[model samples]
Target: MKPRPLDGITVISLEHAVAAPFASRQLADLGARVIKVERPGVGDFARAYDTRVKGEASHFVWTNRSKESLTLDLKNPDALAVLMDLLKNADVLLQNLAPGAAARMGLSFEALHEKHPRLIVCDISGYGDNGPYRD
Candidate 1:
């Protein structure tokens, strides 16, 4: 058997829905410390989807584990600032926000790279960046 490559990395994800969280958790499975960020009041909406498995939302539990749960409203300036602080300590950043959201938030790989030169960023979306499906 071989060890997972991201053993010592820490992944911080600004996510909702599924895709990005799914990816970060895989990184966590390999020993990375993944943090899943969501809105404060409601948390991730997926948590309310259905309590099918022992009162747990299948989607939320599946993509989230061995990670910290951070609640931040990206739309708010203070919250965004807090997220920036979090980025300062992260080795990797993951997100699955809507089309243009990453760029709007300036959380794109290039933007983040300017500060954390060694940080790895991954943006997951239904469509590719600059694609026909983009909004």
Candidate 2:
């Protein structure tokens, strides 16, 4: 069989709610290696949004299918170190965290550009990263 377009691509996704996860799922469908980063124990809050499908959140399943998941408490130094290590080799970094959250943690494009010059960073937010409504 022929290799898919994104066969060797790796995506690190720090996402929740809907948009980012859905986008990454599409990438995963196209054969990217999508590693979804979740909170240590609670995971994505959407997991509790519904249990309509035999005790599982249909939304979560739909948005997260075909991807690997990892638990990382970004607050922990070791966990942050691990994320940094992943970024060093990742092809894309996709996140939909609250505005400025990723930047505060130094995951912003400007922050990672010099080190991972080829890494593609995608930040999805309902509102733009700046302005009064960007919370």
- Over 35-75, each residue of candidate 2 has an lDDT whose tens digit, in order, gives 99999879999999889977779999999999999999998
Q: Model 1, 9-69: lDDT tens per residue?
A: 8888888777787788788988888888888899888887899878879888887877889
Query: Which residue runs does candidate 2 get wrong by more than 4 Å?
Result: 131-133
Q: Model 1, clash count?
A: 0
- RMSD of model 1 against the true structure: 2.4
Maximum-TM-score candidate: 2
- Alpha carbon deviation, residue 116, candidate 2 (Å): 0.8
Q: What is the C-alpha RMSD of each candidate to the true structure, in Å?
A: 2.4, 1.4
In model 1, where do residues sit more than 4 Å from their true spots?
A: 1-4, 130-135
